[model samples]
Every structure is written in C-alpha cells, then in structure tokens.
Target: MTVRGAGIFGLACAHACATRGARVRVIDRAGIAAGASGGVVGALAPHTPDAWNAKTAFQLVALLEAEAYWAGVDARSGISSGYARLGRLQPVADDRALSLARAREASAAGLWQGRAEWRVVRAKAGWGPVSPTGWLIHDTLSARIAPRAACHSLAGAIRDLGGEIVIGEGAEAGAVIDATGHDGLAALAADTGRPAGTGVKGQAAVFGLDRRDAPQVFADGVHIVPHADGTVAVGSTSETEFADPTATDALLDDVIARAVAYCPELAGAPVLARWAGVRPRARSRAPMLGPWPGRPGRYIANGGFKIGLAMAPACAGLLADLVLEGRDAIPEAFRVEASL
Candidate 1:
C-alpha cells in the first residue's frame, strides 16, 4: 500500500498498514515531522467529559490507548516516543466552573469506564495553574508526548515492520491513501470543487523545565505541557489567515506570557525555541477518514487539527480496518462526506 504524506496521520496509517502484513511505502514531499506533526506542545488532552458524542467518545478511546500504542512503537523501534501519562490540570475561575467540575467528576466516572478519574482538587504549588476558586479540575486521562520525537520513533517502527519511507518522489503502489496534512485539504478543495478543509497555522514554544511528572496545564486559553526531556512546551496561536505560515511572531510571545502567569513555576523559564506549522482542520472540526467518494482504492485521512497525535492510534486502526479488512467502523462524522 502507498501512503502520501509523512506527518502523524500518514505515518500512523502506514504503520498500521504495515502491522497488518502489507508492504507499505510512505511518500512525502516535505518529509516526516516537517508539518504540524512536528509541533512542540504535544498535549494529548481530552474534550470536556461533560459532553459525550461520537467525536468525544472517539477521542477518549484513542487517548486511552495511546500509552500502549506508543510503548509498542518505542519497543519495536528502540526509540523513545517521549510519551507520559502525567495527567492535566485546569483551574476553576469562578463558582460556576467549580460546580461544573464537580458534576463532571461523576460524568467522567461513567464515561471513562473506571479506567480514569476526574476530580476537583487544590492546585499544586509551583507547578499548577493559578485557580481563582482555589480549586482545579484534574483528570487522570490526559498525557504528554514529544511530537517530533514521536514521529521519528513511529518512522523507525514502520521500517522495522518492513515498511519503506520514500522522500521527495515515489511511485504509487497497491491501495493509495491521501494522508497529507494541510496541503491535502487544499487539493481536495480543488478536486471536489468545494471547500473540503483548511490550513490553520499554529505557533508553539519549548522552555527549559524539568517538571516531567507534573500534570499539564490548560489555563488562560493556552496549553502548557511538560515533557520527559526536562523541557516544557507551551502553545499556541491559531490563525486562519497568515502571510507567513512558518514564522513565529508576537502572538506566540503572548502565549508564553500567559503560560508563565498561570503557572508561576515557569516565570523565569528561558525560551528554547519557537516553532510554527499549518494544521489541517475540517469543517466538521473532527478527524477526517474513510474512502474517498467516487475514487476507488483511494482513502482520505486528513483533518486531525490540534489532536492529531492523540487521535492517530484509533484513526489509523479504523483506517486499516476499512482499507484492508473490509470493515466500515469509522464514525459517520469522520467520513469524507461529512466535510465535503
């Protein structure tokens, strides 16, 4: 099978195909980890458990399976994906949010299937977000990973499974998949004569910190994730219109400031690097998958948006099942027609 694009979605699909005993070739023009899949802030967080639907349930399943999936990849490739399930913290700003957090604790207990817990707790000093209500919503399901490193590890694992990765150019072989990120969406827009999806540019930064064990923070509309490599990743600025997609500007600076303000431990944190990339976002605001309509032997796997890493495992499995096993388990919301 041939998979185009080497970002998280493409690589994960290739890996899944290879694991199913198919010889696969992954082709990419910009190469692996060069897109939003190479981002710094790799927070594998969840939507509010208060809401339950096909989209939220799909994400929950993927987030729950991420640890073992990444561990298997790491074991096979002999490269660490830098995955850690350290959980997450979100501050309660007011009494209204506090009430909602408490209610969700019960909802999570049922939704999470007793595998995890969501509870209201006091903010941990020096490492937690500032809580105006002196309380935070802590969920044990959230985790963090190094995005670039994860991609490298996944690529290595694919090779170990006898999959070939072709950079620059390659011929299509067997069943074909269009897993290209933002560019694929643009191509679909042109091919279908309609808006398929869009490229949403995001900016993120890594700062020197060693709180690898601390829960990630989501406060003031910013994500602060700590990795195992003694670095904290903070992001991002979502821009739909940009003249320079790869350039980092003052918008990222404001994100950093907010991160430090919410989590005081990062007050003096030195900015190690600023990074930017364009992410594919479908109109449905969900991961797009399944066969391309009117195009036999071709499939679509774009629109991961910000949760590509978290969604990669389940999405890949469903895609492989559809492509190889003749199973059609993909959610209707994730189908190509949902966005097209």
Candidate 2:
C-alpha cells in the first residue's frame, strides 16, 4: 500500500511495508523531518515511574524494537546520529520527590521484569555515580538519536529500497498514514474525520561544547545528549495545546541554565541553534496507529508526543504488520482499538 506523510513514522512505516513486499509511495507536505522530527535532539528515554500502564508498556516495546532497528541502520546506512545507550539520571531537589522516585523504582522492577535493559542503581554503586538524593534508574534500553539525521537516513533508506517519495502538500496515495506530527494532523483530520489530535510544543537548543567535557547522554530535570558534531543537545519545555513553533527566550534561557548546571563545561559553550516544534499528542499518550476509524484506506499514526523519536520504529513496525501482514496484536498498549 502507498503511504502518505513521510515524516519519521510515515517513512518508517513505508520502510517496513516495502520490506514486507508492499509497493510503497511516501508523501509529505514538506521535506522529510520538516516538523517535530527535525528537532536537534531525540532523547529515547522511556517513561519514569509515574507513567501509567499503557504509556509505560508502549515506551518499553518501542525502546526494545528501536535498538534493533538502529543497529541495522548503523550497519546498512552507516548513518550515525550520535546514537548511544547512555542511561538516564534523575536528580531530586526535594525529599518528597525522592521518596516518590524510590517507590516508583520499586514498582517498575516488577513491570520491567524480563526486560533486562532496565535496572535500579543504588547510590555510588552501579553504572555511574548516583545522585545523593535521587536513586539512579539505569535503563540500557534508552538511546539518543540526532532527529534530523535519523529522519533523513530513514527516508534515504526507503528510497534505496525502491520506494518512491513525493514532496508536496497534496499528493495521491493508496493509503495515507498521517505521521506528520502535530502540525500536519489537522489537515489530515479534515481530509478524513478522525478526531484532530492535540499538540504539545517543546523547545530545545544545541550547544557546541567540547566532546571531552560531557557524557553521551545525561538527564536530571533536563536532558543533555552529545551529538557527533562536538555539540550537545539540551532541552526541553512542554506546553499543552501551544501553537508557536519558535523557541522562546525564557525556554532557551532555562535550557541553557540547566545544561550549565548539569555539566559545567557548557557554561561558556557557544550556542549553535535553538528550535521548537509541536508533537502530536493524542487524547491518550499512546500513539493512534490503525486505519482511521471511519475513513477507508486511511490510517492515523501520529500522537506520539514527547516519545515520538523513541517509539517510531516499533510503532511503524506494528502498523506495517497490521496493514501488510494481517496481524491482529500490536503491542498491547499501542493498539488503536484500546483507545477507541
């Protein structure tokens, strides 16, 4: 089936579909990664302990699937977007939050069991040094991706596989997979009557820090991810239902301050760029991935929100499985019928 809206998810879906022996045509309103997927950093952190059941499961499956997908990309395409498995560090500022973090870690042990990539690290014991107040939850499953490079590489892979990509606003396709993040969903809803998904605006910045100064990935309240270009990405601000895609002064200032606080080397680092984009946030944090409820031959694959980058491969794989191979189960948490 031909796929429309060749953003990360769309491109991924097209790739998976073609690999499964389907003729795929990917269409996009703008060039690839022209939306939220173009952001500087794509942190692949799974949900913290506070995440609900469905969201957490969705994140876990996505992380696992992405690891394999990225490894394949690294071998085949040799496009490395600074992908790394550096674990996440959550710092605590208050006593209450500390207690909550500990409890969440305990609870996650059961939920994350059999998932060998995640573990709880005691202070000063495992992996890296832990924070004094907060417990270090080490998730080897987590990864980082250069958003733009991953998108470009995925699109290139799809083309190399003999799939066609048409760049324009209105293009024809056998089936339209609306993976255009937040900005492209409204028009998709208008074209097909699926409820318009909401948007969550996020702001981020890139700093040209010395590579020797920072780890591949680190996170406290904010995340700092190292890129291949001797730079690190720091972000991000979350706003519900916001429209503006330009990074605000307050947000940029806050990210910079946080980056400097996390790693002093960034104190005088030169700012490379600042950007903001809206992720498609569904009513449920889980992605909407299935044939549009009422629209024939049209599918919805947006609403991945903050975790879009982490979840893209798994989500696309499941969608392809359903669309091309007639599979019924699609990562229990991300199944569209569950939300419906």
Candidate 3:
C-alpha cells in the first residue's frame, strides 16, 4: 500500500497498516511533520459530553483509544511521543456555566459508560484556569501528545515494522491514500469545481515551564496544554483569512496574553517557540474519510480541522480497514459525499 503526506494522519495510517502485516510506503514532498501536524500544541481534547451526536461519539472512541495507540507507537519505535492521559480542566465562570457543567456530569455518566468521568469539582491549584465560581469541569477523558514528536515517533514505528517513508520519491503502488492535508483540500476544490474545503491558519506558542503531568486547561477560549517534556504550550488563533500561513504576528501575542491571563502561573515563563500552520477545514466542517470521488484506486483522509490530532488514531484505523480489507466503517457524516 502507498500513502501520500507523511504527517500525523498519513504516518498513523502507514503505521497501522504495517502493524497489520501490510507492506506500506509513504510519500511526502516536505518530509514528515512539515505540515500542521508539526505544530507544538497537541491537545487531545473531546467534545462536551452533553448533546451527544455521531461526531461526538466517534471522537469519544478516538480519545479513549489514544492511550494504547500511542503506547504501541512508543514501544515499537523506542521513542517518546510525549503522550499522557492527564485529563483536562475547564473553568466555571459563573453559576450558569456551573449549572450546565453539573448537568453534563449526568450526561457523561450515560454517554461515557464509565470509561471516563466528566464531573464538576472544585478548582485545583495550578491545575486549571482561575474559576470565578471556584468550580471546574474536570474530565478524565482528555489527554495530550506532542504533535511534532508524534509524527517522528510514528515514522520510526513504521520503519521498525519494515515500512518505508520516502521523501519526494517513490510512485504510488497498489492502493493510494491521500492524507495530504491543506494541499489535498485545495486540489479537491479545484477538481470538483466547487469549494470542497479550505485551510484555516492557527498560531500557537510554547512556554518554558515545568508543568508536566498537569491537566490541560481550557479557559477563555484558549488551550493551555502542559506537555510531558516539561514545557507548556498555549494556543491558538483561528484565522480564516491570513496573509501568511506560517508567520506569527500580533495575533499570536494576543493568544499568549490570553493564555497568561487564564493561568497566572505561566506569566513568568519565557517564550520557547512561536509556530503557525494551516488546518484543513472541509465544507461540511467534519472529517472527510473514504474513497476519493471520481478517482479509482485513490482514497482521501483529510479535513480534520481543529481536531485532527485527536482524531488521527481512529481515522487511520478506519481508513486502513477500508483500503486494505475492503471494510467500510467510516461514519456516514465523515464520508466525502457528505463534504461534497
């Protein structure tokens, strides 16, 4: 099997196929993790446990599968992908939000089926954003992984499994899967004569702080992910219109400011890195997975938008099932026809 784009999605798919005893080859023009998957912030968060739907249910399965999936990658590769199930904390700003959070605790009980807990609890020191209500939505389902390291880790795992990743070389052999991210989305839009999808630029920053094993904090619309490498990542700016996809500017500074305001403990931490990338957003605003329309021997695995990393494990598994075993377990909402 052949896969295009050596980012997280492609690498994950390649690795999954190899683990299943299929000889795989991955082709990427810019090399591994050169796209949005190269970003520093890796928040494997889930949707609210309330208002459950197909998308939310799918993501819940993915988040739960992450621990073992990443652990397998780490074990095979002997490299750390900085994955940990540290959970997440969200501040309760007011009584209204607190009431909603409490209500979701009940919903999570039924929806999560005891696999994880999404409960309302008192805010813990240095574990979350300041809660005006002194309450927080603490969910044990959330996790984190270092995005860039994860790509390399997956690549190494594939190599160890006798799979190959060629940079700007090799022809598509057997089945061809396109996980080419934003570039793939653009090509699809051009070929279809309509907007299939577009890229949204996101900017994020890393801070020099030792806060590993802490729950990720989401407050004031900013994600504060504490990585296992002892550095904290705070992000991001979702800009649909940006002149430069890879340039960090005042918007990033504003994001950093917001992050600091949310977590005062990070105020003194020095800036470690500033990064930006474009995330693929399909017209339907959901994952587009299935055979490439009007193109035989081709498949697409793009349009992950904001939740690409969180969804990668399941996405790769489903795509591999379809491409290799001819099994189609892709959710109807994620089908390419849905996006079209």
Candidates 2 and 3 compared: the better one by TM-score is 3
Instruction: For candidate 3, write residues 214-315 as lDDT tens digits.
Output: 899998889999998889999999999999899999999999999998899999999999999999998888989999888998999998899999998799
Q: Which pairs clash in model 1?
A: none
Candidate with the greatest lDDT versus the true structure: 1
Give the Cα lDDT of each candidate. Answer: 0.92, 0.70, 0.91
State the lDDT of candidate 2 residue by residue for 102-189, as single tens digits. Answer: 6876766666665644444554432232355655555555667788888777876777778888888555667666676776557655
Regions more than 4 Å wrong, model 3: none
Looking at model 3, the pairs that clash are none
Model 3, position 1: C-alpha lDDT score: 88
Model 2 residue runs over 4 Å out of place are: 49-52, 94-109, 114-137, 169-171, 188-195, 211-220, 241-243, 331-340
Q: 246-300, model 1: which lDDT tens digit per residue?
A: 9999999899999999988898889999999999999788999988777799999
Regarding TM-score, does 1 or 2 come out ahead? 1
| Shift of residue 66 alpha carbon in model 1, Å | 0.8
Ranking by lDDT: 1, 3, 2
